[model samples]
Target: MTSLPMSDYYFRQFEHDGADAPAGRKGRIFSAICQGDAPTRKKLATDMALRPATVSDLVMELIHDGLITESRPAQSLQKGRPEILLTPAPGRLCAVIFHFVSHTMHCAVVDLAGTILFETTEQVQADKIDKQGFIDVLSSLAGKCTAHIPGSAKQCGYALSLPGIVDEPGKRWVYSAYWPKLSDFDLSEVSETLGHDVIVRKNLNCELRARTSRRKSLGTGKTLLIHWGIGIGAAFISNDRELVLTEGFGEIGHCVLDPLSTVSCKCGMIGCMEAEAGLWALATMSQDQSIPINEQKFEDYLQDCTDKSFLKRPLLLMAHTLRNLTLTLMPDEIVLTGPFVQCPETFQRLTERFELIFPEGALVRKGRKPKIVSGRRSKSDELVGAAFDLFRTEIGALCRI
Candidate 1:
C-alpha cells in the first residue's frame, strides 16, 4: 500500500478505445484531483508530466463530464495570477457502504470525494437472522439507502465490509465464527439477488484501505495493520495492490498462541490469539475481576484497566503475537489499530517489549524492526475505508470513460 506518487499514472486500468479516446493520462489526472489536492492546471501538468495545454484539454473534458469542479482560488500574496483548483464534486458520484459488526449492520452512503452523505445503524438478532434472512436484511437496507441518494449523483455501486475472511476471487466467505451463517457463503450468488454489482471485502482490509487513504504517504512501502479490537484482524500492504480480499487473508485471528492454553477462540480453535488478546480476552478478564464492562467509555476504562496488573498478561500475550507476526512478515510499518490498542501505555508497552524481543542482534540481524504507529480514524475506520475504496474505484471507472 505504498503511497502512489503523483507521477504514476497506472493507478487505474483503462483500455485505450482508439485514437479518438482520451488515454491513460486522462484517468491519472482525474484520480489526482479526486485525491483532494485540488491542483491547478500548471500543477496538474507538472505532476502528470504533460504539457500545460494537454492538461487544459483533459480538465475541460472532465469538467464537461461533471467529474470535477473547478474554482479559482482567491488572490494569493506570493502569486502573480490566481490558479483554478480542481476538486471532486459532491453528489456527482456515490457508493453504499455496509459494515457487518456484531449483531448490527452499520450502513452509510458515501460520495466519491470522501463525504459521508448518509448513515444509519440497525441491529438484528444473530440467532434469528439466517443466511437468506441476512441477505434480505442487507438488500432491504441497501434499497433504503439508495432511495435516499440524490438523482444527480452517479451510483458507483455497493461495497461490503464483511466480518469474515472474504475470498474475493471466489466471491465467498471463508470463515466467520461470530457470524457462522456466512461461512463458505457465495457472495456473487447473492449479488444478483440483491440487484447490484457488489464489492465484497474483509472488514480488516477495508479498514486498512481507509487508513491508507488518510495516510496516502504511508501507503508507500510494506505495512502490516493489526486491528486489535473486539477481534484481531490482520492486513498487509504492498505497492499498488487490491485490499487482501482472499480466503484465509484475515484469519490471523486464528493464530494459535498457546497450544495448551484453556482459552478458546470463537473460530472453535483452542488457544488462538483472538481468544488470548482480542477484546473478548480483555472483556473476559474484566468480568472475572468484577470490573464493569463500561461500553460507553471503553477507552477510558481501558486506560484505567491497564494501569493495574490484571490486564498485563493479555497485553503481553498480544505483544508476543504481534512480534511473531512482525518477524514473519517483516513489514516496514506495523499499525496498531482498533479499540484495544488505543491506550497510549498499552501501545507503548507493546512496542517496547516487541523492540526488546525482536532486536537485530537477537533475531535476523538484517533489517530494521518495523515502526509501530497508532491508527488514525479511531471511530468507524472500517466503514470509512469501505467507502474510500469504492470512491477510488468510481474515480478510476470515471476516468476510463
Candidate 2:
C-alpha cells in the first residue's frame, strides 16, 4: 500500500466518475498486464507505444508496490537470456464481491487478476430476511471473505452486485420486484459497518460487462444480452467495444404490453412485460397451484406440465418483444440468460417462435438477421466481472502506488 490506502482510493473513485483514459504511464502498463494484452516488458512497450526504458521503470515501480511479479519462462527457442513475463500478484489488491440472486447471496474474495481466492453461498427465505438481516449477513460474509485475503494483499473494498434498480451515485438499492421488503434501503452507511467502502451496482450490468469481453468471438458488431429472470432486462455492447446505456437503458420488463390487463407488475405497473413473462410473475402463477418458486424446480415444472398452452402467452409476449427489439437494434447476436432461456425446451420454443415472427424475409433482410443463443451465468463470471470492473475503472489509483 502507498501513503494512502488503496481502500480509500477506491472509495473516492467509486464516488466520482474519473477520466476514461487509463491513468499515467504506470497505470497504462498495469492495465495492459491486467488485460493480458502484454506479458513481457518488450510487449508492453510495443503495445503502449512507450520506450523500453520507460516501460522498465514503470514495471519496476509496479513490482516494488507488490501489484505485479516478474518470472522467467522455462523454455526459450532462440534467446541468449530468458524472457521475463509480467503477471498480477495473486495476493495483492483484492476485492470482496457479493452477488445477490433470487433468494440467495453468493460471496467471493477475488484478486486483481480475476481469480477467486474463496467463495460461499447462503440461502434465505424471502419472507424471513429484512433489511437488517440482509446487512448482518453481508457484513458477516465480508468479514469471512476478508479473513481469506493473504496478509500482503490490500483489500480494496466491497462490491454489491444486486438485482433491480440501483441508485449507484447514492449507493442505495432503490427497488427490486422480487425483494420488495428491502426496497428503498440505504447503503451509504454500509461502508462504516464493514470498515470499507461498498459500491452498489445492478447485477445485469456486471454480468454484461464480463460477457462483453467475448465480443471478438461473438462478433465485432452489436451484441445484446437479454436476461429473462425474476426481472426481464437487457444489456448491449456496440461494435466499438463500448457498453451502451450504462443504467436503465434496456429495461424491457417495465414496458407496458397491455393497458387494460389486470396482471400487476411489481414495479407498480399493470400489464408490463415482466408481469406476464418474468420468472417472478410465473412464480406467482405456480404458487397458485401450490408449487414452490425455485428456478430449477420451476424449470422442472415447465418441462413436466401437461397443458403446454400455459406457456404460450408468456412465450409469445417475449418473442414479440424480442422480435421488435431485434428489428430496432439490428444486433449481430442476442444472448439470452436466466431460467426461461436456460431450460432447453422453453428456450427452443421461444427462439422458434421468434424465428417464426421475424424470419429472414423481405422485411428483415438476410444479413441483418441476428443469431439468438442461450447464455449461462456462472458465479465465477459475476465475481470476476465485479472485481475487474473495479480495477479497470479505478486503475489509476492502483498504479499510483
Candidate 3:
C-alpha cells in the first residue's frame, strides 16, 4: 500500500458534524457491541484493543444511555464469575434504507446492529410518473417505515440510494437517464416532508459506502466500484477516502467508445458503453425483453448471450474502460458488481483483462498492481452498507441527541 499523508478520517462517508464528539468512546463501544454476537466487557476491551477498565467505564456509559443492556450471566461450570453478555437494546437505533432499482424502490428498515426490521418495495412506471410523484412515494415509504419501528426506536435518518447523477454537495438528483423527468429534482424536498436528514448518493456509491470496512485497513479506503444494472456506472473512493460520485461521475455510461457506431444510448449518446454493454443495450441489441436482467440470471444467461458471441464488443468496451481507469486513477481496489459482472465468465474475463493490462502500470512503479475484483456482497447486502453509512455518521456524532 502506498503511504499517503492522509488523515485518520480517510473516508468522506465517515465525516460528520461534531455534535457527538463527546461520545466518541461510547459510540465506538456501542458500535463494537453491534458487530459480533453479544460481547462481554472483557471481550469488548479485547476487540477494541482498550484497557479492561476503559471498557468497563464505557460499558456503564452505554448502559446508562439505554444503548446497551447487560444480560444475566450463564451458569459457568468451571469459572468463578460468569461473563456478563452485553447486547444492544432491541430497536434502539434504526434507519430506513431506500434502495432505488430500475422502476422499483426496495425500502428496508435496519437497526444499528444491521438487522432488517422490515422490508417493502414500491414500483412505478417510469414513463408515467413525474419527479414529484417519485418524491411523494419516497416520503410515503419513509412514513410507513418509520411507523413500523417501535416508538422507542431512535429513527436516526434515511439513506436513499438512487440511480443517476448524484450532486451530493448540492444534494439533488441532477439528471436521470431512467427517469428523464426527474432531472434537477431537489432531494431536500423529501427530507423536508419526511422530517429526516436524508443521505442521498449514487446507488453504486452507496454500495461502495455500504461495503467499506468498519475496521480501517490499508486498502479499504481506496476503492472503485463499477456496477452494471439497467445501466453502467462507476463509484470511486480516493486513497484519502473521499468518495468520487459527483462532478461528471454520471457520464461514465455516456462515454463514447465507438465514435462511428450506429447504436445510441438511453442518455442520447451514440456508441456509449451503456449503448453497447448495459442491460438496456443487451435488450436492445438482442431484441429480447424476456431476458432477466439481474445477477442471478447473468451466470446461465451469459452462456446463452455469448452463444452468438453477442458479448464480445460490450466486454471489450468494458475492458477498455477499466484499463483507462486503472492507468489513470490507480485506486487501491476496483470492485465489479451488478448483473453483468456477476457472470462467472464475464467476471473471469474482466479479471484476466485487468491482470493483463494492470501490469503495464509497472513501468511507472516497479510492480504496483491495484486489486481488481468482484464485489463480496450481493444486492441484498447493499442495504447493509446503506444502513452502515448512517450508522457510521451517527457513531461519529459521539451520540447525537
Candidate 4:
C-alpha cells in the first residue's frame, strides 16, 4: 500500500472544537514549536498570527502540562534579559513504534524530539503466525517497550507498521507476501488489547515520511519514492505537502505488466510488476549462476557481479515503470530506495536506463524535470517517522497531559 494506513481513531484525534478554541490553539502552538517554526513565545504569536497574550496563555498551559519546557539562552550579548527559548520537554510524552524488518518485529520507544529511548527486536516467522498469534507477539513487544517508559512520562500513543495492502480506515491487514497466513486480519481490536490508541501504517509510507521530514527541500514539491526489493511498493507526497493517504494508494507492485505472462506474484496474480523485477525474482534467477547471492550483503553482491547482463531486463522494466509513474505524477523529485538502490553500480545503471526513456531536454518543461536520487531505508527512520507523525497529528490529545 502506498498510504501509511493510519487507524480510524488516529484521524479522529485531529478533530478539534474549532481553530479559535483553546484546544485548537494549543495544538497549533505545540505543532509550531515541534516544527521549530516558533521557538519563543513572541515567535509563536508572530508565526501563528495570534496575540502575544494568547500565545502566552496556551504556552503556559503546555508547560504546566509538561508538554513543553522553557529555558534561557546560554549566551546573549546585547540583551538585559536573555530570551526564554521553548522546546518540547524530553521524556514527557513518548510514542511506541513497532515495525517489521524481514521476519523480526522491532519495537522502539521514541520521545517527541525523535529520540529512541529504548529499542528491542524479536524474530517472528511471519508464515507461521496466525492473526491472534501475531497480536500476541505484538502485545508482548509493546508491553516490553511501554514498561520502560520513564516514570515521569505518559504514553502518547503507539504506531504499528505493517507490510502489505491494508484497509487503513477499517484497520485491517488485507495481505502481505511475507505473511501469507495473515490475511484480512482485523486490527480494530489491537488498540483495545494494547490499552492505547494504535496507529497502523504501511512500512514504505513511514520510510518516505521520514525522508521528507529529514530533507526540508523535499517537502516543497511532489516527491515519489519507489522501493524495489523483496516486495516492491511506492509512496508519494504531493506538491501540496500532503501524503496521499487514500487506501491502497501505492500498490504498484501488483500492477500487471503483462496479462499473458505466466510469471506469478505473491499476491496470487500473474505478470505483476514484482513478478518481473522484484528482488525475489532476481534472487530466483541468480540461483543457477556463479554469482554469489548473499541477502545480508546484497549490495556487495550486486557490485561484485562481473556479468550484469542478467540485470538488463529487470532494470529496463523498472525504468519503464518509473517513466510511466513520473509522467503521471510529474514529481519534482524521484527517490529510489531498498536494496537495489544501495549498490552504486546498480543505481547508476538504473538511472542511466531511466534517463534513456526520457531523452535529454524531452522532459524539460518550464525548465523543470524530475531529479532522481538514491535514498537510504533504515529501521531507525521508520520508527522516528511513525513517532513524529503521531506527535504532529495527535498533538491536541497529547497536550492534554
Angstrom error at residue 46, model 1: 8.2
Q: Per-residue alpha-carbon lDDT of model 3 for 1-401, expressed as tens digits?
A: 11111113322322253323443556656655655577889887776677899789878877876777888656656567788888767467778888866678778898755678988888888757887788788878877787799877877788877777777656788766678788787877677788888887667665665555433775535677887666788877664455555556745787876788888766665777787788766866686666665545654576567463666777778887887776667677778877667677777877776566556555764565667777644554566666655655655564433
* Cα deviation of 303, candidate 2, in Å: 2.7
The residue pairs in collision within model 2 are: none
Q: Return the lDDT, model 3, position 187.
A: 79
Most accurate candidate by lDDT: 4
My TM-score estimates for the predictions, one after another, are 0.79, 0.84, 0.78, 0.84
Note the Cα lDDT for every prediction shown. Answer: 0.68, 0.73, 0.68, 0.74
In model 3, which regions exceed 4 Å deviation?
1-25, 28-58, 76-85, 214-221, 238-250, 261-263, 269-271, 286-300, 350-366, 375-377, 398-401
lDDT winner, 3 or 4:
4
**Model 4, stretches more than 4 Å misplaced?**
1-23, 31-53, 72-85, 289-295, 361-368, 398-401
Q: Candidate 2 at residue 88, lDDT?
A: 66
**Per-residue C-alpha lDDT of model 1 across residues 1-401, encoded as one tens digit per residue:** 11222212235454345333456667767667765467888888777667889889889988977877888766666656678788856568778888865678877887654567887778887645577887888888887888888888887778887765677666677666557666678878766876767887777776666555544575456778777666677888664544343456657777776778888676776888777766656677564564433322556676666355665776777777777877787678888766566788777877777777777687473867778888653335665566554556656766664
Candidate 3 worst ten-residue window by lDDT: 1-10
Better of 1 and 4 by lDDT: 4
Give the Å shift of residue 14 in candidate 4: 10
